[model samples]
Target: MALQVQIGKTELKVNPIGLGTNAVGGHNLFPILDEQAGRQLVQTGLANGINFLDTAFIYGPKHSEEIIGEVVKENGNRSDVVIATKAAHKMVGNEIVMDNSPAFLKESADEALQRLQTDYIDLFYIHFPDKDTPKYEAVGALQRLKEEGKIRAIGVSNFSIEQLREANIDGYVDVIQGEYNLLNRDAEIELFPYVMEHQISFIPYFPLASGVLTGKYDKNTNLAEKRGKFFQKELFEKNLEKVERIRKIANEKDIDIAHVVLAWYLTRDAIDVVIPGAKRADQVLNNLKTLDVQLTVDEIQEIDQIF
Candidate 1:
């Protein structure tokens, strides 16, 4: 059965797995092996009943969003799927600076609309807050987008509790996106509590911890990348070691590691829509299949122990 979850005031039935387009043409950190493969991945995902797809404006230097727009346009009937994309981060000089100002948000929305070939997005997120931009500036910008009918809903990704509190002070934000996985639960401390009390959505990115909880990486293996190489260190190593215990529980339960971690998230009180990026068609299938796996309270507890 497909799982349907709500995001704030927006009511839409969605499969728990959202096809994330971070690597559509390629992210700034990762290079795309093939853009065609990325488009095919979206088609296959839609065919498999995935109605939610996440992408961003600055990916592939913005080539990825263009490709997504082309593919979704070619596929047609764009109404069948809910398109979720983010803004606020752009390349300025050699650094990736944040631009969450209302004016920038409006400009980015128009550009994203043209790229996605749609007038209104189902859910639009402010990619992340940066020291350069004020929270009210970002949140106020999103409020304007909502009023102008450019974006149907607004959310923020990668917010600390203090940051989230600042955004919600105006009650303009509809969702709060963060990196919450079996390993990372700091959001549970204050962020989740705020969301639960106010009825805001929690969209967890890196729900799989960059594939560490997927059981694909081990102590013997090392992660490297052009920009992703920055995450390699002792803390990451300890996190991977903790994943081994979750892997064992997944094995004993006869479920894939991704399923256990995803299903475990569903048991939480927060209204979550976890988007795990899949570079290939089969990975998309595997992630969507987690909808069928139900985690027991004990199983949820067992996995939570390591993180």
Candidate 2:
């Protein structure tokens, strides 16, 4: 069995490396996706000992959870997997808006339960903080759900430090998900200490910085067009230099650079899970390679300095 770690103070124990299901049925996010391939990706992950499956209501707007539900039901492994999903996006007459109100949060959890085809969610997050709802009040709703046995744990995503503070005011929050990776270390400065103090597990999304930390891109590659605005010319070139340094360590260890990167995150404080999304079965298998990588303290510091 893959080694298990606790998610915050919750009773849920999951493999440190989880499958991020945004690409599973996120046809709306990525053009020209194959639903069959997406199912294969989940099957491959579960077969290989990955127990944590992270999804959200906004991904495919609902399809990701539906697909995951079908796969879990077909495999009859619902009890074996620790499924984590998020909400907060509500349809508003052909437009989507963030809603953290208590009623909406309660309604969203019930709807997500249907989409996931499960009696209870392992971890459910408030995907984003709406402008109106008090953060604590929103989390209070999820706390109620937990108490009623509708969900197992409560989480908050994309929340600022202050918002996280308010959400966890009652100490009901179990995990916090946000953008974090080797290239982006802001969480280390702003979020880690707080979560560490509160005993909340931190699950980093985009753990590979959307593949930039994978050490596959070259200086000439146009990442801006491919990845997004964050990879503009100057910043991309600087990050490439850092990736090269990590590539040397990866080569020395005889492992894939992406594996080295993921391994490094596991060593950091308060980071309990790293959910890297994959579109192919092979890619899903590749992510599992991260578990075998054991970095020395000096190497960890070297990687820390490189980024």
TM-score of each: 0.90, 0.98
Model 2 scores a C-alpha lDDT of: 0.91
Candidate number with greatest lDDT: 2
Q: Per-residue lDDT tens digits of candidate 2, residues 188-251?
A: 8879999999999999988887678898889878664786744778888898898889888899
Local accuracy of candidate 1 as per-residue lDDT tens digits, 1-307: 4556676666655776787778788756474466677888888888888888888877776777788788778877787778888888776788878877777878888888998888888788888787866787788887877888878787888888888888778888788888777666778888888898888978887887777778777666645541242247776688777777777777876878878888788778885677888788888888887887767778777767767
Error of 2 at 78 (Å): 1.4
Best by TM-score: 2
Error of 2 at 249 (Å): 0.8
